[model samples]
Target: MHFVIERNRFVHDVQNVAKAVSSRTTIPILTGMKLVATNEGVTLTGSDSDISIETFIPVEEGDLQLVDIKQEGSIVLQARFFAEIVKKLPGEQIEISVLDQLSATIRSGASVFTLNGLDPEEYPRLPQLEEDLMFKLPQDMLKNIIRQTVFAVSTQETRPVLTGVNLEIENGELICTATDSRRLAMRTSTVERNDQELSFKNVVIPGKSLTELSRILEENDELIEIVVTENQILFKLGHTMFFSRLLDGKYPVTSSMIPTQSKTSFSVQTKSLLQTLERALLLSDGKNNVVTLKTLPDQQIEITSVSPEIGKVTEDLTTSEQEGEEMRISFNGKIVIDALKVIDSEKVNIMFTGAMSAFVLRPTDHKHYLHLFSPVRTY
Candidate 1:
């Protein structure tokens, strides 16, 4: 197999695919990247069981030439070394030739390196799913949904379901929810489903996978195709494809967890509240990351935090409007700040169910986004 590719374009594709290659993978061959050169283009793929990413560089995109293939073949090369070498190649083009015995020789200008390549036949095949169940949404919208919920996913692996974000589609609306038992984040958006009767339940995706996928995706208005299967989800972004395995267990029913009534409801400036929480957290220790919110009768709220080693912080901010009963509640300062960051509106509505129940935070303009935080017991 022999091919010549533009150095910069190849480097970009390699970097994107490398996100799926894990250095700690138990399967040695999975650590390398599979490269297939055909008449159309060259395809690069990487997989680490949980996630797989494939990107193709066409021979010519419109008027620009990207790759030229002399022989049609496939080979797997060491991901880490090959990526580094491609980035530092001397010229504008890279020439790679695979000889007998699975040996690869790469040349660019005066630089030459020989790498032992593996037969691509040994690599695991990616799942091929029927396109019957598919949804289309702008790439930026999908990324925003991930950002609003991924932070609340459980980090502990004891409950595998909580470590992933639950995704469900019904009535042409897509809902995404994430929870760690202490805090929950939920976001809903309308989607254009290809089939009116197409719906899915218990489609839980790992938070880590979504986080990495978001990082690799560019913020653009381009449409992205999402294909869902029983065990895998595929994301098609132009010439790149991303695949993630769905978590096996049933996600907890989170709708019932939302409070139906609240004793106190008020609207406050989001920036002010977030700034107050950030300053208050400075005095909180790692284990005791608690912050207190006291509602004063003067249409103001007091935020405070105390630490034995550090000091105490107290800040007061006037609320936009306060109603119902006045109350005081304690919660994780870090979690509150995380929830606040995703809110896009200037004012946020805070609903509290007395001092002992979980409180809800949501944007005043956008009612579809909700964040709930469980109160922390402070003696």
Candidate 2:
């Protein structure tokens, strides 16, 4: 295989694919990236079983020439070295050629590097996905959805299903939900489809894959195509393809966990509440990280956090509105702070069903996203 390519474009594509390479992969072959150069363009693939990312650079895109093919072939390059070498190449153009004996030569400007390349035939093939069940949504929208919910996925593998975000599509709406038992984050957005009756349910995508996919996608209004089968999901964005394995086992039915009524409710500036929670967290320790919220009859909300060894921290803010009753609730300060970070509204409304029940938090301006946090019991 031989090809001379635009250095910058090659570097960008390499970096993008490298995100899928896992350093701890048990399969040695999976650690390297597979590159195929054809008459059409060069395609680079990286995978670590759970997730695979493939990106293609056409020989010519519109009026731009991205790659010049000297010979059509395929080879696998050491991802660690190839990724690093591509970036530090000292020129605008890069030339790579592989010999029949399997040694590869890379040259750019005054720098020359020879690395042993592997036969591409040994690399695992990407999963074949049928396009029968597919939908489209804006890239930025999907990125936002992942950002808003992936954070809440369980970090512990005890409940593997909770380590992924559950994605469900119905009635033209796509919803993504993530929870770690103590807190949950849910975001919904509209999907575009030619078929009005298209719908799906219970597609759980690993949080790690969602986080990597979000990082791979740039902020854009361009639509992304999503294809789903029984156990895998594919995301197509421009010349890039992202594939993730769906987690096994059913995701817990989260709808029932959201409270239907509240004994105490209040609305306050989102930033103010977030800041107060952050300040209170300064005194929090361990898993408890507890913060107490006391609502005064005067409609002022007082927040406090205390540690046996450290000093207590407190803040008070006047609520814009209050209803139901004056109450006090304790919650894991860190979880609530993380939940607040995803809210994109100036004002946030929080509802408490009771001192011990799960409470709901959401932006007052948008009804599409909701966050729920289980309060910590503080006597």
Candidate 3:
């Protein structure tokens, strides 16, 4: 294989594909990246069994030439070394040629390096998914959904299903929910489906895979095509394709956990509440990280935290509106802070069924997202 390509574009594609390459992969050849040059363009692929990413660079775009193919061929190069070398190569263009016995030569301005290549035939083939069940979503909106819920996924391996975000689609609406038993985050959005009759449920995606997919997607209004199957999901962004394997177990039913009514409800400035909790968390017990919120007369609330070995913090915050029965609730300060950081509203509405029951937090301006937190029991 021989090709001369523009350095910057090549570097960008390499870094995107390298996100799937893992050094600890059980398959030896999976650590290397596969590069194939064809008549249309050059394709780069990387995978670590569970996830795979493939990107293509066309030969030319309008007036600018991206790649000049001298001969069409394929080879696999060590991902770690090849990625580092391509970034530091000092030149506007790079020329690569594969020699006999799977040896390759890389050349740039005044620099030449030889790397031993692996046979591309040994690399595992990516799944060829049919586009029967496909939908479209804006790139920026998809990124927001991942950010709003992926953090709440359980890190413990006790319940494997809770380590992923559950996705359900019906009647043109898509809902994403993630929880770690103590807290839950959910986001809902409308998607455009190719088939109006298409609907799916119980599709759970691993939190780690969604995080990596979000990192590669650019924030823009461009529509991304999503294809889902029984065991794999695919995200198509321009010339790049990302694939992830779905979790095997059934996700627990969470709808019944959300309360329809609240005994205590109040609206407060989101920033003020977030900042108060952050300050209180500094003096709270390290293990529990608990902070207490107690409603007072005249639409005011008190925030306090105390530690046996340290000092205590107390602050008074006036709510915009308060109603129902007055109550006091204690919860993990860190979890609330995480939810507040993702909210895009100036005012947040919170509701509680009782002092010990799970409370709900949501933006006053929209009903698209909701966060639920279970109170922490404190003596």
lDDT of 3 by residue, 216-307 (tens): 98889899999999999999999999999999998988999998898999999999999999999988666789999999999999999989
Clashing residue pairs, candidate 2?
none
Lowest-sum lDDT 10-residue window in model 1: 280-289
The lDDT of model 3 is 0.94
Summarize candidate 2's per-residue lDDT along 254-289 as a digit string, tens digits: 989999888989999988988988888877666688
Deviation in angstroms for 336 in model 1? 0.6
Let me know the TM-score candidate 1 reaches against the reference structure: 0.97
In model 1, the clashing pairs are none
TM-score of every candidate relative to the true structure: 0.97, 0.98, 0.98
Candidate 1 stretches greater than 4 Å from native = none
Query: Compared with the true structure, what per-residue lDDT tens digits does model 1 show for residues 1-379?
Result: 8999999989999998998999899999998999999999999999999999999999999999999899988899999888888888899999998987388999999999999988899999999988878999899999999999999999999999999999999999999999999999999999987689878889999998999899887789899999999899999999999999999998999999899797998899999999989999887777768999999877898998988776888999999679888798999989889999999999999999978899999899977889998999887
By lDDT, the best candidate is 3
Backbone clash pairs in model 1 (N, Cα, C under 3 Å; residues 3+ apart or in different chains), count: 0
TM-score, model 2 to reference: 0.98
**lDDT (Cα) of model 2:** 0.91
Query: lDDT scores for all predictions?
Result: 0.92, 0.91, 0.94
Cα lDDT, model 2, residue 365: 98
Q: Local error of candidate 2 at 77, Å? A: 0.6
